[model samples]
Target chain A: MADVEGAVLTARSRVEVDGWQEAIRASCQPLLEAEAIEERYVERCIEMVEDEGPYVVVAPGIALAHARPEDGVKRLCLSVVTLAAPVEFGHSENDPVDLVFAFGSPDSTQHVSLLRNLARALQADLADKLRTANTVEEVESLIQGIVQDVKED
Target chain B: MTTKGNPEKRLKVMTVCGVGMGSSLILRTTAEKALKQLGLEVDLEHVDVSSARSIDADVIIGQAMHTEEFEDAAPVVVTISDFTDVEALKGKLKEALEAQGWLT
Candidate 1:
């Protein structure tokens, strides 16, 4: 597994958004500021949800927002944004998402290791912890714990 | 080469999403774990839903939104609600495999 020490960026606090579109935009703001991805990437992600459906709501209370690397990814990065209140993404099984993860990958390979590690972490209590976390450090530590666990394994 | 009724014939499984880079990759990892537990070998790849229609594969795994677009593209289309739930994925995959006569 790749070391995820600096790969993750967390919002300073749980953000208040009007709906899923704003939720996705807020989630990708950190990546946009870091120059890891362009504005088009964020727009494309929203467009995808509009065109298709809420398939990004991969789990209950969680939304993983991403677009094609060709859309505008400058590097490989991930961001976490927790909502002050849950927003519905129209997903029947995993609606009312409070945690959103935005991913930016320049290519196909590097993100796989991070995602694989994330997949393991998500299966645990990480989502619940993230949703209820009060501080950015708390969210950071929660993600760091996942990275540390992967290293140990 | 293996003869008839052999389980060694590797199956091609594709995991798909709208953009293919994010959730599909995660689903691929989960599917790999599920297939390993079932003692099945598979050639798994992740693709966008748009490209998935033309890609040849024995089974296609994706969210309900995307899978409905390719119902006729593959012999088996498995709709997964939660990508992180490996047990659910395993059960769905096992049922699909058994229905296709790939598992007994």
Candidate 2:
């Protein structure tokens, strides 16, 4: 199983930009600015979204954006932004992604583990609560619940 | 007397991820099913992405982020979102193999 640290789920709670790239960048920029990840890594994450159209939606309402370590990843952080309204990705059952989780890992091996663990955790009802969260604290609480569950398990 | 009969060699594939479990294994199973439908016999293995460079296979499949590791080893690489979307992945595998002329 992948080692999952409790995500710092930021209460972005909405798409603040027009296009998908802009929205992802908006969601990711704060993490970069806080030194959670390097700036170049954000660009690569955006590129992955543009290239693949959000194939990382492991479950309903949750989408994980990531790329290779060489794309300039510096740290491991799970930054999140929930849209007030989900956005369209122009794919079947892929649109309306309410929760955007951006993962930045320096190693591909680590990333796969992370993806697996994350997918497992999100498969629960807590992920659904996260989708409908109205406040940042509510989102944080949901994330905390998952973190606790992960630890206990 | 010259021997002229030569059987076609089976294609080999490796689907790798962080661990040889979970989604990676799911992907491996999906790839195997797809290749079988394509009438290709494959030798498939599941390993960590770090060991991907050492694995000997004709194609390596994984998330797009890990593409660089297998860039030199696997002549055909298919990077998709996840292996859950069997139809989409089938299309991607077909495209990759056909591009490499590995498809009959």
Best by TM-score: 1
DockQ of each: 0.72, 0.07
- After superposing candidate 1 on the true structure, give the runs of residues whose Cα lies further than 4 Å from its correct spot: A1-8, A149-153, B1-8
Which residue ranges in model 2 land beyond 4 Å of their true spot?
A: A1-9, A111-114, B1-104
What is candidate 2's lDDT per residue for A2-115, written digit by digit as tens? Answer: 345623334466555565676677677767776767778778777765664455553345566656667666665566777766766543444666677776665655444444
lDDT of 1 by residue, B1-104 (tens): 11136646678899999878888888898898998888887899998887887789888998888888789888889999899888999999989888877876
> Between which residue pairs do clashes occur in model 2?
A14-A82, A68-B65
Q: What is the lDDT of residue B96 in candidate 2?
A: 80
Candidate 2 — what's its lDDT? 0.62
lDDT (Cα, tens digit) per residue for candidate 2, span B1-104: 11113245666788776534434554665676677777777788777676777777777887665665677777788876645455666888888877766664
**C-alpha TM-score for every candidate:** 0.89, 0.57
Q: Is the docking of candidate 2 incorrect, acceptable, medium or high quality?
A: incorrect
**What CA root-mean-square deviation does each model show from the true structure?**
2.5, 8.5
